[model samples]
Each structure stands twice: as C-alpha cells, then as structure tokens.
Target chain A: MNMHTPLMSASPLVLSVEGLAKHFEMHHLNRTLFAFENVGFELREGEFILLKGENGAGKSTLLRTLYRSYLPRAGHAFYHTREGIIDLALAADVDIALLRRREIGFVTQFLQARPRVAAEELVAEPLRLAGTSYAQAIEEARRWLAAFGVKPELWAAYPSTFSGGEQQKVNLARALILPQRLLFLDEPTASLDRNARHALVSRLAELKAAGVAMIGVFHHPDDVADLIDREISLEVKTIADGENNVAE
Target chain B: MTPASSMNAALERQPPRLMLADPILTMTGIEKSFGDVRALRGVDVTVYPGEVLGIVGESGSGKSTLLRMMNLEDMPDRGEYHLALPGQEDLNLFTLDRFSRRMLRARHIGIVYQNPHLGLRMNNTSSGNVAERLLMAGERSFAVLRARAKESLDASEFPISRMDARPSELSGGMQQRVQLAKAIALEPALLLLDEPTTGLDVSVQALVLDTLKRLQRERRITMVIVSHDLGVIRTMADRVMVMRNGDVVEQGLADQIFQDPQHEYTQQLVHAKL
Candidate 1:
C-alpha cells in the first residue's frame, strides 16, 4: 500500500490499488487506447482523496476502474472485506455484488433511472436494500431530501424528468443513504447550486467523521478542497500502434 | 495478514449451523379455496431461514396457491400464519392490517410468477417494469429506483443496453430474467417462485436456473419454489415437500426424498421423473 497522504492513521486501509491500468480496444479502427497505466493509491478509513486533472486525463477512468465499473487490465485492488482482503480485479462477480451492496457506494455525474419512478423511492432504495422497513426507509429518504433542500412537492416527481441540478441532488442523496465504508464520488456537485453544494459538503464531513473512506473527482475543487486528505493526478496516455505517448 | 493466523481466524469465524434453528415462515393448517374448488386443505409448512424449500405437485395440487398465501397475495381461508422477520415478532400476517401486510410483502417477500407478463408491465420500459415493485414499496425517488433497477437488470444478466426497451420487445427468456430482476430488486428476505422456468426452452431453462442458483446462494435468500419439474426441485431445493390435491403427502430432505420416497405419491412423482 502506498501511503502518500499525511492524513493516514491507524485506521485500516479500506482500498489499496497497485499498478492498476485500463486500456480500451477499438476493434473497428484496429487500434488500442491506453486510458491510464501504473496508477496506484491507498485509501484509509475516513480519508477523502481527490482526483485532479484536466479533461481527457483518465481521471474518470481511474475512478471507474477502482469502483469496478470497468475491469482493470492489470494489477490488483485489494479491498478489506468482511471475508478479508480480496482483489476487486480478480474477485468473483458475486463477491463484487455483495461488496457493492453493503460496503461500497458510488455517486456519478449523470442520473440514470427508470422512467416514471418517483424521487422519494430513488432515495429510499439503499435504505431498503439495507433491510430497513419500507416505512422507515421512505421516512429516511424524506429526511435526506429535506437536508438537500429538494422541494417537498417534487418528492413524488421522477428524477429522470428533473433538471440536471435536481437530478444530481437525488444522486447524492441516494449514495449517502446507507453508511458506506468506501465511497466513490465522480463530480457529485457539478450540477448543484451553492446551498446544495454546502449541504453535500457537510454530509460528506459527517461520513468522514464516521470513518467512511472516499475517492472523489470534483469539478469545483474549491467546494471540497478542505475535506481532501490527498490528491492524485492521472495523466492521459495516447497510444498509436501499440506505442504509448504520455501527456502530462 | 499471516496465513496461519488468518486460517485460525477463519476456522473460529465459521458460521454456526443455522439449518433449522431460525424459522423465517411457518404455516399451520393453512386452507384456501377458489369458489367450487378447494385449492388447499389444512396444509402446514415451516421454512427455515436460508433454506430452499421445494413444493412439488401437478396442476390443481394447490402448490401455487400455497405460495400465494405465504407472500400474502391471497388470504388463507382458515389457519394461522406467522412470518419471522429480524428484530420483530413472528408476525401473524393474517391479523395485520392491509397496508402493513402490503409493506411486509414489499419488504420481506418477492414472487416470480410462471408467466413473466403477470410479474412485469409489458408496456413500460424494461427498467421501469423492473423498478415497479420498489415504487409500490413506497420508494419515491425515481433516480434511486432507476439506478437500482438497472443494477438489478445487470445482476440478473439481462443486457444493460436493452434495459430502456419495453418488456414486450424482449424474448420470452429475457422477459423472465427481467421479471426476476424486478422481483428481487428490493432484496427481499423470502423469494417465491411458481414455475419460474417452465416456459423457457431447455437451454434457456439451464441458463435461468444457473442465474437463479447463483443469486440465491450469493444473497442467501430463503426460497420456496413450486414446480412440476422434479429436476428443478432436485437442483434448487434443500428440502422437498410433496403436495397432491391440496394436501401435503410427504416432506423430507431433497436427497433423501429423491433417493427413497416414503409416500406413494412421492414415489410416483420420482418414478415419473426417472
């Protein structure tokens, strides 16, 4: 595990990614694109690490890879699971599903939902999955909505039809519903206004205090700059005919 | 983490045998009828947590009716029913109010019908149909429901790219998978299946069965499967209950029951399969 952050404590390391790499094959063009290579990081409990880089820097790819959204082409992501340390890259799909359901949480920039599902249900899902009673889960969803300043009237409205900012609020609320041990947030506040952003920051702080480890990519770093324990930058790698051209 | 120390810890942490200690659902003298036809007659059942219980019988044997009563889709005409949920009493479901019963059903029980059409909304988008149960369970956040529905669809091995299409647009096997995704989207404690793979082709049946087995084992879901196909029961069930003409003929471990059936009906059922 690479301890590049001064904020590390005796708290157990939740995730340790070593020499992780992601590459995409363009079969149509008969070429390959190396999104990132030799990326490594260690996230301890309660620490928040920020991902910094310009567009096309593979920042999102790195986040996605760690979250197991995209399979890593190489290396290991050792996660401290109830079953002990298991590599996310090599773990069975069933194991990954179990971890995602109970241990890990993710918030993405775009909101993807079923058409016509009400907003409250969206927020209550995580709580429900955690075995909370339906009434209690919905009640908690209502509480989160209030915290984010989502209008009560829109509680029954579908997030799929909501404005970009409103949808992001729902995304943030859903991700934060259950107390996650590890959280990956990608531009969670990109569409939020001042008040919502502040609310998100405060909620994130509460999670941090509760010893939840987090890795995030923020469009506005100033909003959460104080909460960040460390920073990792991913340089874009352009490959032509199997040759890598690194761009800093 | 040293290998020797970790091995010792793993041995110490091995879960105690929970086979029959925790009863998730218990039914005594359950009876149901459909007008002139008496579907179930004083049937008793006890399901332990994390155990797969199979109910096997032919059509009109009341196996499906028993499943419906367990999940509260239909009320039992006579008998006491109790559902054991964590941190709560063994709830007499018949005594609870309709709304409370509905809430419990949404939270604790998930059922997949023989016909996917009955379980899924044919007109709605695939994701919408999959998320319908959560919506009904009082989840009001569309974003969460949609995201969970998509997640469930992916987990069930339904193509993610086609999640936006209508259920009617998908093949029969795909539709069944979608319905399975929808049923378990809430991650309910008890999953009820009534001939879940009956209609699919043999190859598709194998695939669906593989998916179901993996899901049940991964989630540790307590399942009550009612199927005419003894092969399904043999593969998926830990215990087998043989039902005939609304009456339970015999009950025992799947291996024992299949190896040497006690009841004549069970013998015939096993013999037919052979």
Candidate 2:
C-alpha cells in the first residue's frame, strides 16, 4: 500500500469528498454489486491528485460518481462554488447542470462524435456554448487542434472516421478548450501518441498553474509523477466481503 | 502568467450571452388522443428563435403527434399554443379557424417529411414545386416566381440541370433535395422536419443534412426536428427532448442528454446508440 500525506496548500478547497460509496443492484441475479465504498479525498485549487487502482478496482466508477454521472449510495462530495458549498451527491439536477456548464468538465476514453459535425466544430462547441463568437471559437479550436498535432486538413473532417489516437486527440481538444474550475479525466492519455501526450501534459501543467483543480486516472503513472500531489488507491471489494464494515 | 489564470481571464472576458433568446413557439399542457389510444399526455415545449430543438424516441413515442400539433396538421385535444413571429407575438394558434390556420402555416411554417412524395408533387418539375410554395405565399409575376424558385433550389444545392425534372425522374437523394427546396422557398420563420434524411444512403444523408444545416445557418430559421435516428438529432439540435410512451423522459442541452443522461430510459436509449 502506497499512501502519501495530503499536500498542504494555501489555495481554497475546491472539493472535499467523504465516505462516498456506490453499488448497482442486479435484479435478475438478486445481487448487490458494490462498485466502491469508503472513498474519500480532498482537492484544492491548482492541485492534481492521481487515482490509482488495478482493473475492476472502481477508479473509473469513483470518478464518475464525483462527476455526478453515477449516483452514489452514501456520503457527501462537497464542492465549493461562487454561490456557496453544495453536496454534489445530493445536488439537484438543475444545480449540477449549471455547474457543468461553467465549472466542470470530464473527458472519457471514447469520442462520441455527433454525426455530420466536424472535428473543428466539435472542439469549438464548448466555447460557442459559453457565448463566444463563431469566428473566435473556430480560431481557438484550430489552435488547439494544431497544438495536439491533428493534421490541419483533418480539422474539418468528422472524428468518427479518425483512428483511435486521432479521435482521442480531438476529444482532448474539445474537453480542454474551455477553462474549467474542476476537470475529471479518465484515461485521457491511453490512446494518445507520444507527441500528443506531451502536448496534453503541457496543457495540463498550464491549467494547474492557473489554479484549476483536477482528479484524473492515467495508465502510466510515471508520465505524470512530477505533477501529482498525491495518489488515492482504491481497493476492490468483493461480494464475499460482509457489508457491515462501516465504522460505528 | 500561468495558463490557468490566463484561461480564467479569457473566460471572464467573453461577453455574457444568454443561450436562449425569446422563445418563438411555446406549447403548454399539450394533450392528444386517437379514439381509445392516448397519443400524447400533458406535455409542454418552448422553442427559442434560431435554435434547432430535436424530438427523439422510439416508434409510437408521441414525438410525431407532438410535431403534428406544432405544424397545425393535427389539433391537440387540449393545449395553449403561442407563436412569437413578428406582428404576431401574441397569436394563439388554437384560436385560429381552419382556413386561417392553413394560411398561417403557409406564411410562417415549412415542413419536410421523411418521404419526398408526401412533401412534393411527383408530377411537377422541381422548380414548379418550389414556385408553388412561393405562389401560395401570394407572390405574383411569373418572372419573380421563376427567379425566386431557381434561387431557392440553388440554396438547397439542387442541380440546375435538373431544375425542370419531375420528382419521379430524380434519384431519392435528389428528390429529397427538391422537397427541401420546396419547403424552404417561402423563407418561413419556423421549419419542422420529420426524419428528414431517414431513407437516403449514408453518404447521401450527409450531403442532404449538410445542405439543410447550411440553409439553417444562413437564414437563422428556428427548427423543430423529430427523428428516431439519434445521430441526426445529435448533429443538428442545440437542445433535445427524449420521449417515451407519451411522456417526456428527459430534456436538456444536447451535450447533457448525450454525455450525462440522468433518466434511466434516456440512459438506455443513449447506450443503445453507442
């Protein structure tokens, strides 16, 4: 077990999660599958925490739960917003939606490209949604695409036709286009080539300098070892394990 | 000088623009039934100007029924419908009589169906079909109608060489373009599409949808599209409403629906597509 003490920072706390847990009930099998339990962490502005675990250890599930893509069974993920602190696990749908619009961003492994929308537009969409003019947004998208080593000619092509690496580059460009206060990245570099991976790391470095809080899972921990403030390793809990393990 | 601070500054400098402007169409508590079957339950929708709102669901989801109500092709059993077109901001669609409704639809609304035969006259030339819509909008003078018809056909990317060909003579893709030319000829404020590219070849579907997207952007026409094809909805809509068994399961910005669907039914639909 590799555990490091949390880094002391002066920056404001962005997220503080406690006793978070999630489980899925399989109706047909009459089984309760516990994805993860007793997961907790704290992240401050500009801090990067790397999530580590073996396969089926629920790292992705924990990230999704923090992002509110999956509902949690217990505990609180208290996020600090300009309005005030709110429990993400219990936040209203509309409230979560508002946060997603301006403060939160998540990048998964696969690119779910909309049919007929080009790569450039896909990258520019977040900025456009936030009210940037078409000209400016497209210009910014091109800049990001070029930096990520996507060929200029392919910028206008649909990402569905691209290779896995190429599509992941487009995905990264789109997700990182907008400056988010808190970002969740799940295996973002898994499909990236070395050049694109370097570009992504540099971009992430910039985000950290600007005080953007982030929690991410990476296949190669050494690539981001220098940037990580700490690591949170999740242990898999099997069905054979008793459910009454919570502290009284 | 950190990238994060710069990024935050850049975001701050952006002008605050509201995602939705004044709604061009608003329907409240819309209900409809066919004999013993309830096609639609109490539902409401508000469509903003210059935005594409997509309605999606499986067959018999009442998506088509709700769309028909918007186009005035079918009357809802109970609902309050309002149009915010110029000089008619306060117009209530239900209050209008049949003839008045027809005239209103002709002047302000355009619809494109999945089957070109439903929207086009197979006997008429492509230009003639387009001109017919212009003629109904009360335009006179053969010279003006002829020029406008050609312009609209060109806007839809219909081949100038096929301008005089009947719909039956054209390929399926070309026929769909002709229908598009006819629907958009009147420059209607609101355009409603029912599975606009459902039957075309994949390549042809892309072309047709591209033409529609260009026209929409150039003209800034508000659009309401109903399609069982999730890809079509994902491509064109700024907002999406998911329907299931006569109820709205979820509705939100397109990204929200596709990326982080909250409703169980919506998640199933999205996952099935993936």
lDDT of 2 by residue, B190-222 (tens): 899999899899999988888887776557688
lDDT of 1: 0.79
Candidate 1: chain B TM-score against the reference chain B: 0.89
Q: Rate the local accuracy (lDDT) of all candidates.
A: 0.79, 0.82
Which ranges of candidate 1 are over 4 A from the true structure?
A: A1-7, A240-248, B1-274
TM-score of chain B of each: 0.89, 0.91
Model 1 chain A: which ten-residue window has the lowest total lDDT? A24-33
My TM-score estimates for the predictions, one after another, are: 0.51, 0.75
lDDT of 1 by residue, B224-244 (tens): 999999988887887788888
List the pairs of residues colliding in candidate 2: A210-B4, A210-B5
Q: Candidate 1 residues A1-248, lDDT tens each?
A: 23434557677899999988776533333345677888888889999899987787888777776766555667878888755787776564334545677888888867765454579988998787678887998899999988888999999998878888888888889889899999998888887888888889999999999999999999888898778888888776666655653321
